[model samples]
Target: MNTGKAHKSGLRVVASHSSLWGRFLQGDRHAFAEIYEAHIDDLFHYGMHFCQEKERVKDCLQDLFQDLWSSRAHLSPNVLHIRYYLLSSLRRRLLRALRKDRRYQHRESWEAFEFEYTLPQENQLIINETIAEQKRLLHKALSSLTRRQREAIYLRFFQNLRYDEVAEIMSMQVDSVYNTISKAIGLLKKQLPLPLLLLLLGK
Candidate 1:
């Protein structure tokens, strides 16, 4: 499928972000609301992946937007990607909240980012044994990935973020983000068709 238009649309959003963020920084309430309306769902989805607790994610989102609005004067005027800024801020908040929870203190490894996979009912009937086996193998390959690898893939693919943006959100180097996604794709390729893998990842 031709993706040029989608790419151009993304550029428009980046350009719009520059203007919208400026208004927000200047304490424009309408701009602040628009920013919230545009990103709240994405932020909440990301938050849920970071932490499974629904209420906790909601609380973090509430605090995040509240702080953003209240601290508008101090926020950087150069935020060219509002989604990136919100995602990064929510991540820090979730991590801090997790740290304070005694249940997570002694955990050996953090949970991997979780995303659901479901075949439509009509498609399910048409899917044969071969496809079913491939799906199983794909799940196995995905499950083999490390937590960081899963998070990197989620941010880069599911969130449609650039490597640099994923790096900043995850607090890692850009090269690390590239390598992590490469490795994740490499694993998936071993189990599923390369085209199908890329399609599922929205590449």
Candidate 2:
């Protein structure tokens, strides 16, 4: 299967939950599978951003989907996007997992977590060759940030999360979340050219 095309089509299908929910509730297993395929990568990536450990992220995801499947009859698909719901659920599960594992708790310092995007090696090399200078500057500026600042920026820009959601995920007060993100932007401004800074801000 063309997984990317299938995933996009699944999201389009899921746009109207009332209709899709009806189909799913009426014993359409394919509908559920489509929902799963569309969201698994997003869930995995989001979980990894917070949890860092691959095994923990995988476990959290498995537990989340297992819970969802077990409680499928009670789910209110009309009230929420499954993607957002799963992310929120997985975040909670990760927190619980951290609490249970002392090693994970110790590693909870945001700086210890690294965010990586895995592109095809050839494409990554090509892109790097094309934008080497800009990439270096961007990386330098990013590396200068504290973990909280980096998380705030990534959640706000990369994940398109609202300040409230970022605060919730980061376990900070909403005002604090705003302050962290603002400070991060200020620091980036000092390191980046005006045009590049503007582009980042525009995002």
Residue 5 in candidate 2 has what lDDT?
29
lDDT of 1 by residue, 138-187 (tens): 67777878888889888877778877788888889877777777767676
User: What TM-score would every model get versus the actual structure?
Assistant: 0.79, 0.67
**Which prediction has the highest TM-score against the true structure?**
1
Candidate 2 Cα errors over 4 Å, as ranges: 1-18, 25-27, 108-137, 193-203
Once fitted onto the true fold, the runs of candidate 1 whose alpha carbons sit more than 4 angstroms away are 1-17, 106-111, 120-125, 129-131, 193-203
lDDT of 1: 0.76
lDDT of each: 0.76, 0.67
lDDT of 1 at 53: 82
- Candidate 2 achieves a global lDDT of 0.67
lDDT of 2 at 25: 57
